[model samples]
Target: MSDKPNLEEVTSFDKSKLKKTETQEKNPLPSKETIEQEKQAGSS
Candidate 1:
């Protein structure tokens, strides 16, 4: 395994320090519905 830090590891470390979830930046991904909608729109 690489020594490089993963986001989950870094974020978990912060949580151990009592960091608030709401205050932390979240990684958002497009939902399947939204992705399909965009694809359909583009293909039109």
Candidate 2:
């Protein structure tokens, strides 16, 4: 039998920290132009 841990059995992982870190590494919010365009599209 292989010694590697079973990936399918792990269901308690908290990914919020990882996601937050990744978002922080990149821009947390969209740019002003993009936000404006989205708003305009939504209004239309």
Candidate 3:
């Protein structure tokens, strides 16, 4: 056997691949009446 140890190959990690794609669209908040209905529905 050779005196030198066998080495494993290492893969280069790309930072761009790790980054998450952000959604451009923003969801609007619920209306006042909708909020009241939600609360009433949950309580009943």
Candidate 4:
């Protein structure tokens, strides 16, 4: 009984961690060049 709950918790945590990693990989943050271009456009 105790082992079952522990295993379920571990599996759920791992799935969440993997999902976060995949999301980050799919949608990366903007780069420095992109930021600079945005600033330049805004100033103009």
TM-scores, in order shown?
0.42, 0.38, 0.41, 0.42
Cα lDDT for residue 32, candidate 2: 100
lDDT of all predictions: 0.79, 0.77, 0.78, 0.73
Residues 1-44, model 3: lDDT tens digits: 99976554324546676768887758888999999999999999
Q: Summarize candidate 1's per-residue lDDT along 1-44 as a digit string, tens digits.
A: 88976688665564456755556547888899999999999999
Candidate 1 C-alpha RMSD relative to the actual structure = 9.4
**How well is each residue in 1-44 modelled by candidate 4, as lDDT tens digits?**
45445565665675544544333476889999999999999999
Q: What lDDT is obtained when candidate 3 is compared to the true structure?
A: 0.78
Per-residue lDDT for 1-44 in model 2, tens only?
79988777457776674644333445578899999999999999
10 Cα displacement, candidate 1 (Å):
16
Per-residue lDDT, model 2, residue 36, is 98
TM-score of 2: 0.38
Looking at candidate 1, what is the lDDT of residue 29? Answer: 89
Question: Which residues of candidate 3, in runs, are more than 4 Å off?
Answer: 1-25
RMSD of 3: 9.0
Candidate 2 vs candidate 3: which has greater lDDT? 3
